[model samples]
Target: MLTVLMLGDSLVEWGDWPSLLPEVAVINRGIAGEMTEELSARLMDEIDACPDPDAVLIQSGTNNLLFGYILFPTMLITMLQRLRLCYPSVPLIVNSLMPMPIVAPHDLEQINRELAVAAAATENCHFLDTVGPFQEQCLPITHPGFLNDQVHLSTRGYQVWAATIKGLLEQLFPGKLPG
Candidate 1:
C-alpha cells in the first residue's frame, strides 16, 4: 500500500481519480483557482496534509499564464526546485500545465510542455504531458463536455485525460492509479 499525492489545479482532481483508487491512497490537493505562487505559498499545508505519499504528482502553473505576466518554463523551474527542496527523496511526477482554450499569448499548455521536458531533465522530476484534447494539437485545449470551454475537464474530458496518462501512471506506479 503506497501513498500518492496529487498537487496542482482542478486538472489533477477533476475526475476524482485519486479517490477512485483505493489501493494507492491517492491525495488530490488541487485548488480550483490557484497558480504556482499560490501553491508555493501554501506548500507546507498541502504537503503536511497528505498521507505520507510515496509519490507526488505536480501539475501547476496554468493560472499564471492567465495573468499574462510570467513565462511558463521559468515558473515551472522555480516550482520544481522548491518541491525538490521540500521532498528531496520522494518520487516526483511533474505534469505539464494543461493547454487552455485557444487564445494568443495564453497558449500556456505548449509552453508548459517545454517546461515539463526541462523539469524531467532534473534528477528526480519526470514530466507528464497532458496535451490531449486538453489542448488543440498541443496548442489550445478542447472540452466537448463543458460546452467547448476546453480548459476545464468535463466528465468526458477527465476520461480522456485518464486514458492518456493511465499508461504512464501504471508504468511508474505499477497498478496504483486505476484504469
Candidate 2:
C-alpha cells in the first residue's frame, strides 16, 4: 500500500483522510492551531514515526494569516526544507494556503506565489494550488463550497479537495492507488 503523510494546521487536522482516501495508508499528523514553528518542532517525530512515507502532503499558513504573522514565506521555506531533509526521495506535495475571507485577497495571493516559488526550489517538492478551485477569480473570498463560516471546509469542499488530490496521485504514481 502507498503510505502518505498528511501534515499541516486545522485544514489537515479536520479532514477525515482515511475515509477520503481509503485506497492508501494515510497518517494524519495535523494539529488544530499549529504554526510553522510548532510544525517544525514536531515534524521530526512525526516523520520518524513513519520512517518511509511514500509521499507527504502539506497545507498550512491560514493560521499565520489569522494571527497576523509576518514571516510566513521564510517559515514556509523552512518547513519544506525540513521535510526534504527527512525524506529526500519522497514526493512532497506542498499545498497552497486556502482562501480566507478574513485575509485580503492580495495578501493571500502573495503568500501563495511565494510558496509556489519556494516549493519549486526544493527538490522532490510539488506546489499544489488548492486555492483556484475553491475561490473566485483573484478574490480571497471562497465560493459556496466552503463551510458556513467561510473559513473551514464543508463536506462538499472536502470532496472537492479529495478529488483534486486523487487526480494528482493518479498522475504521479499511476496504478499505485485505486480510483
Candidate 3:
C-alpha cells in the first residue's frame, strides 16, 4: 500500500485527501496554529508514524512567518533538511503556502513563495507553487473559490490542490497516487 505523511498547519488539514484517497494511506499531521519550530519539535513522532511514506507533502510556515521572526525561506530550508535527513529516499513535495490578500504581497505569502522557489532548486525536494491557482488571474486574491482564510482553503480550494497533485502523480509515481 502507498503511504504518505502530510504535515503542516490548518491549511494542510483543509484538504479532504483522506476520504479522497482511500487506496492510499494518508496520515495527516496538521495542527492548527503550529509554527516551524513546533513542527520541527514534533519531527520524531511524524517520522515514526511515516516509517515508509512513498511521499511527504508539507504545507506549513504561514503561522511561523505571521508570528515569528525567522525568515520564511530559512524556516522552509530547515524543515526540508530535517525531513530529508529522516527519510532520504522518500519523495518530498513541499506545498507552497496559500496567498493572503489582507497580508501584503511582500509579507508571509511572498516569503512563502520565495521559499517554494528556493526549495525547487534543491535535490529531492519538489516545491509546488501555490500562487498559481489560489490567485486571481496571476494576482493576489481571496475568493471563496480558493481560500477559507488568508491561509486556509475551502473545498473549492482543495479542488485546485487536487488538480495540481494529480498532474504531478505521473512524475512522482507512474500510475500511482502522489499523496
Q: Of the candidates shown, which would achieve the greatest lDDT relative to the real structure?
A: 2
Q: Rank candidates, lDDT, best first.
A: 2, 3, 1
lDDT of 2: 0.80
lDDT of 2 by residue, 33-101 (tens): 888777877878888898898899988777887788857768878878888888889999988887766
The deviation in Å at residue 23 for candidate 1 is 5.0
Q: Model 3 misses residue 75 by how many Å?
A: 2.8
On TM-score, the stronger of 2 and 3 is: 2
lDDT of 1 by residue, 1-179 (tens): 66678878766656577534544566778888788777777877876676366878777766676676456566666766766777888778877655545435346645765776767666777777766545443322343533365567666556656555555657777765544
Error of 3 at 143 (Å): 6.3
Candidate 3, position 34, lDDT? 85
What is the TM-score (0 to 1) of candidate 2?
A: 0.90
Index of the highest-TM-score prediction: 2
The weakest ten consecutive residues by lDDT in model 1 span: 138-147
Backbone clashes in model 1, listed as residue pairs: 134-141, 135-140, 135-141, 136-140
lDDT of 3 by residue, 19-109 (tens): 6555567788888888877887898888887688888888777787667554656766777887788888887888776665555676755
